[model samples]
Target chain A: MTTLVLVSHPQLADSTSQQFLKESLPDDDIIWEHIESLSSLDVAQEQAQLRRADRIILQFPLYWYAAPAGLKQWEDTVLTRTFVYGDHRYPLADKELGIVVTTGMPRQAFQRGGAEGVTLDAALAPLAALAHRAQMRWLPVFPIYQFGYLEEPEKLQLVVDYQRYLTQPQPDSLANRQDWFAQRLDGMVARLAEDQRTTGRLIASVFEQNREQIDQLHDTLAMIKEQDDD
Target chain B: MTEQSQWLSQQIDQLAAQQEKFTDRAFWLALKQVVAEQDRRSEQLGGEVDGRTWRPDRW
Candidate 1:
């Protein structure tokens, strides 16, 4: 799927988390645009980009529990009523709208009784409402809380998690996650060094075997469940 | 973990350790996680199948 990642950080270069995320962006079918970098908003071109993308990711740092001013400006300029729901043509209908929001506060801070006393969903309700009006599928928000404090392991995991949020199919189930990884295994194995190549292929083969085994077992379980229903 | 899964994890760890790039290592390690998920899910499904098949009422 073609994913359009619209990042709205005023000082993109100065933000370490944003820079790290930029470097970790997946290398396929993605169009990354920095909002503040654009001198002028070409409404038609921006609308066309939105039209072309299967998934539209609005990525930004949380500023007072809302997106930065730049994103709001882009929305006002580009998402004209005529293009969105005017003239009865809902061009963005059925498209996926996802959010990648980073916050300085901890994850627990966004709860009802927490320090912030507001959830990410509550903070981003306006965006969700806009998605609703356009008849788009609003994905569950992907929030990165306290990005500065993350250690090596968490950051490493974030690489794949972020990529999946941008590109993988909805629901984020194990089956879909498996398919995502399985699709990339060949390319990953090919990239390994000569000596490591054999081991990579072996691991890939075993992974595939495990996947097939799980599928077969699932089928068997389904059959038994069906019998029990009789 | 099953013997096969244990072996697979070791192979993945070795491959990840050998990778020069951070992203490549991340890919391998993240994949190791999915492999672990696969093992856990397989075990759960296997157990459920066994439990359902041993029904004394049906016998």
Candidate 2:
């Protein structure tokens, strides 16, 4: 199937890692839909692109353990309920989705037991769910790990490596790709969307719980702010 | 479980506040599944994939 890679790297021209990765990907079967070139995309066009592809990959560089702020903004603007959910099926449903993020640290910096001890997966967990809600298949991630370990000249390999990872699918291949955790949403999206019947039970349990807790926190924060105002 | 719930909630709050985005239950449910599967897959294969052998199953 054809793939649409929605790249969201800031200053992609200056990013050697992204450049190398893009260069590595075979032009056939992969369409690099650079969000940068799109400049400012409208939801209609974004939705159209999502509808057109069998797979959609988010390509960007990580900032503070997540995608640049622009990506969060991208999702907020593009993934609205009317087009992404509700009675009308989102353009992303059943379409494979994944990520490729370049970072500026060693892989050891992001993990449960490593230097930073905060897993990249944990950091990007929200994006994972968002992909799921959109009904896209969450493919494996392509993370350019230990980015600080490489010299500028060596970074092209990291980009090329990520491009190669996007070409493949399957749980095992996902784990071994060049950029670990760059793709943080694929597994869940695939599991949830690939099977719809069980999704209901999952929603009631996990989905409802997240909402409840989040609401509680917001309510608490609001009250505290009011107290401070008082 | 309470602590986990609280932490999860906090993350949601941070994202929503910073982004002005609503966190849908559907998104959370979908994300929960992704976390579960990512954990499972890592347990099973421990980071290894043959680049030549992957394909996208129709969305």
Candidate 2, superposed: residue stretches over 4 Å from native: A148-161, A172-230, B1-59
- Categorize the docking of model 2: incorrect
DockQ of 1: 0.90
The DockQ-derived docking category for candidate 1 is: high
Q: Residue by residue across B1-59, what tens digits does model 1's lDDT show?
A: 98888888988999999998888899999999999999899889888888878879867
Candidate that would win on TM-score: 1
DockQ of each: 0.90, 0.02
**For model 1, how does the per-residue alpha-carbon lDDT over A79-148 read when each residue is reduced to its tens digit?**
9999989978899999999999999999999999999999999999999999999999999999998999
Please give the distance, in angstroms, between residue B49's alpha carbon in candidate 2 and its true position after superposition. Answer: 25
lDDT of each: 0.94, 0.58
Task: For each candidate, give its TM-score against the true structure.
Answer: 0.98, 0.54
